[model samples]
Target: MFNLIRKDVIALKYYFLFIAAYAVMFGLFTVSSFSPLMICMLPAIMMTLFASNLELRNKSMLFIGSLPVRRKQIVLAKYGSVFVYLALGIILAAAIRAINEYGLGVEFPLTSLNLSLSAALAMAFAALYYPIQFWLGVRNSSFISFLVIFLAAALIGGIGNMADSLTFDMLPTRAQLVIGLPIAGLLLLYVSYRISLNLFLRKDIEG
Candidate 1:
């Protein structure tokens, strides 16, 4: 299982580098907002599906599918890789936030919101996405993923705007939403994994 996860990391090495470049570019020259944190998160949300697309193209899935591994393990490994990228994004965001706050001596906006928002975004995307990818395969999943992300971004942005108009006392405590969203997101991800695991197993049997 660990090796399967490692294989994905190895295969996506260059893509990860590209994400680093993206982080640096967005980090250095950004409006101080949740946008930077959200942008940094896009890579994590995109990579698992991207890696699966690459595997499908290269016929690596055929090789991987032929292995002694279980279908559930394959799904789990893919889900695990999402966190690996999430961690990468968090580290990049933290470093960028540090540079913006300390090194530049500029007060960065949303510093308090960065980590939790990143986690919430990543987990939200993962929870919503993985089942679709597993059920539809990469090609079919791509469009829906894009559509969902777009809609979600709009909804979240609207909610943020609304929240901004309220006094701090009226807002859900940042502590509450930040913590609750990720917990809920993780539960959703687990449910998604179960659904995907079942789908993968059926596919494996049919194949």
Candidate 2:
């Protein structure tokens, strides 16, 4: 499993440079709290797609399956890579926010809320994205994923001001939402993972 994960990391070695560039670009340019989170997650999403493609392009699916690894392990490692990338994105977002706040003496408003919102959204995205990719194959599903990401970004960018203007009384309390959103997102991701595993197992058995 670790080697599977490592294979993805190695395959995407050059892409990390682009991911870093994206982090810096969005971190510096995006003013809205939630929007920054969206920006930070973009690379992670793209990286997950790229990693999955790496396997598909080389027929690593059959190769890995022919090895000692289980089909379930392969599915788990694929989904697990998404989580790992998300964690890295969150860390990068936090670091960028901290630098903006303390090092640059600029304020990053709603830092915690932004992190939570971004994470929940990312998880929701993965929950939707993986099943499509797994079922349709990445080649067929990539456009749909791109479209979803674009729509999400448009919503966040367009509605950020309205979201910022809303009073605390109009929405759930920060404490509640911060915990609730991530939990919901996690549940969705878990469900997606299970579905993907079942799909993979079914296909493997048939093959």
Candidate 3:
């Protein structure tokens, strides 16, 4: 599992470049808002690149599938890697927030209800995005098609003020959401793993 996470982080080198760029922009803007938004992209980027195609291309899945490891292990390892990334992002963001507030005199909260909510948003994204990656194994047209659809929907929503119209405030408060998101994420991940296991067992690891 550790090795799998190591491989995942290694594959994320390029993704970190985007993260670095986001960091610079946040500093320029002197706002933590964008910072959390950027970190929330972790799952999307990871799924699109590493989780989706990686296991298949690298044959890690095949190798693991051949071993005594259960499908749950594979799913759990992927979730574990994302959690590590999320933790790292949170820590780094907090550090930067501290520096910006203390050193730069930028007003950013060390801990905020907003940040808490954003973190939950990150989990939701992670929870929803990964199973497609796990099951499709990257090169499958289904994943690509869904990716396109999701992007298009987002773009169209952006153009149409759908975000503004949405009643987002009705959801749980930040504190509650923070606790709820991971529980929801874990449930979704388990469901996804079960689906993936059924599919994998019914299909071909080498196919």
Candidate 4:
């Protein structure tokens, strides 16, 4: 499991990506709050899906299945790798936000909430993509699936905001954005994992 996790982590070109994402976050998005981090998550999701795709493409699943490990363990490790990567991204975002606040001496607005929200979104987005990649083989379904997911998120968010004023405002901003959003995102991740595992078990491991 440790080796599998390490392999998954190393397989992703994270350093170069971090440099690119960091540049955007610092140069253009230094002051902007959620948009930059939200936008950056798009790539993180793609990279994570691609990492899983690599294993699929290279026929690692068969080898993995032949081992003594349980199928759930393999799925969990993949999910765990996504989590570690997302955690790293959140840390970087926070560190960059701190630098911007300290260097410019301006507080990063919505610091904790935004960072947590971004981490949660990134994690869930990555997880959600995996089942599509697995079930549809990443070749056929990924383009349409990703397109629909993007559009759906945009539409839902827009609609939610539009109704926000009229909707009963029960939770504080800190609770809603900081705590609730992540919990919701985690539900998405859990669904993704279950669906992906079922798909993998039912379909050919050669995939």
Candidate 5:
């Protein structure tokens, strides 16, 4: 399982330079309270899609299914990889925030609220994504995922104004919300993993 996770990481090594460049460009130019959240999420989303598509293109899952590992381990490793991407997204987002706050003197800061929200949102997206990826297979899943993400982004954008005004100081139970979002996200992931595991186990890998 750890090796599977490491394989996913190594597969994306070539993209690090491009990911950094994309982050820096978006960070410096995009001036919105939501920008940090997007910065924190887009990488995870993009990488998830990219890896899924790559695997589908190469029939990698079929090969992986032939390995000594169990389907459950494969599913768990893929879930683990999501965390790796999320961590990368957070680091890049924080770095961008730091550069903007100090180097460019941008008023846009990556607040803890933003971080928490983004992390939760990323997990939420993953929860929605993995089951579909397994059930439909990656080839079809990518299109559906894109549609879902687009709709989600549009919905979020509609409420962006309201979200922009939100702050830790504004909420009565700010600490709980901050801590709870990620917890909820994890719960969602756990449920999603179970669904995906069942789906993958029953799936016809040779198809």
Candidate 6:
């Protein structure tokens, strides 16, 4: 399972430099208006898509299916890779946020709210994405992934805008939100994993 998780990372090793550069460029370009959440979450989402595309193109799943590992492990590894990408995104975003906040004199900081929201949003996205990807196959799921990405971007942007005007007094306390969202996201991911595992077990791997 760990090897499967590492395979996704290793497959994208050459692209990490490019990903970092893109993160920096994206942060600089959108820092003023975009939510910090976008910076933190988009990379994870995009990398998952890229990894899927790569795996599909290489027919990696068929090879993996022939190995000793169970379908359950494959599903778990894929789900685990989502977090690996998320952790990478957070690190990259934190660097960008630091530069923006201190070096560039911008006010955007890596608050707990931003971190929790990023985790929640990314997990929610994985929850929706994996089952579809497994059910339809990666190539067939491309259109759906794009639509999800578009909607996620729009939703997060709207949240960023709303954050400025919304009063915390009417909502749950900051601590509650900080705690609740990630928990919700994890539950979503668990449900998604079960669905994906079932779909994968039933899938026929084409050699």
Give the lDDT ranking, best first: 6, 5, 1, 2, 4, 3
Which lDDT values do the candidates have, in the order given?
A: 0.74, 0.73, 0.58, 0.65, 0.81, 0.83
Cα error, residue 163 of model 1, in Å, equals 5.8
TM-scores, one per candidate:
0.84, 0.81, 0.68, 0.75, 0.86, 0.86
Candidate 6 lDDT, tens digit per residue, 1-207? 999999889999977887788888778666654556777787788888888878878988778878999888888998998899889989988888888887988776678898998899999888888888888876675776787777767876887788778786766788998999999999989999999889988887543
What lDDT tens digits, residue by residue, belong to model 2 across residues 1-207?
788888888889998888878777777676555546665566567887777666667667666767888877887887778777877787777777787888887666636666677777777777777776667655564576676677657755765777788897787788987898789888988999999887776665221
C-alpha-based local distance difference test score of model 1: 0.74
lDDT score, candidate 6: 0.83
- Model 6 scores worst on lDDT over the 10 consecutive residues at 28-37
lDDT of 5 by residue, 80-127 (tens): 888888889899988887888888888766878888888888888778
Worst 10 residues of 1 by lDDT: 106-115
Off by over 4 Å in 5: 154-172
lDDT string, candidate 1, 1-207, tens digits: 899989988889888887877777777776456546765577787686678667766767778877898887888988888789888877777777788778988665544456667677787777777777667776565576686688668867987899889996787887787788677768877887898888888774222
Q: Residue 161 of model 3: what lDDT?
A: 88
Where in model 3 is the C-alpha error above 4 Å?
Answer: 13-18, 29-32, 40-48, 51-68, 110-112, 141-174
- Residue 73 accuracy (lDDT) in model 6: 89
Which is the better candidate, 3 or 5, if ranked by TM-score? 5
Task: State in Å the error of residue 27, model 5.
Answer: 0.6
To one decimal, what is the Cα RMSD in angstroms of model 6 from the true structure?
3.0
Better of 2 and 3 by TM-score: 2
Worst 10 residues of 4 by lDDT: 34-43
| CA lDDT, candidate 3, residue 52 | 47
Off by over 4 Å in 2: 29-35, 139-141, 147-170, 205-207
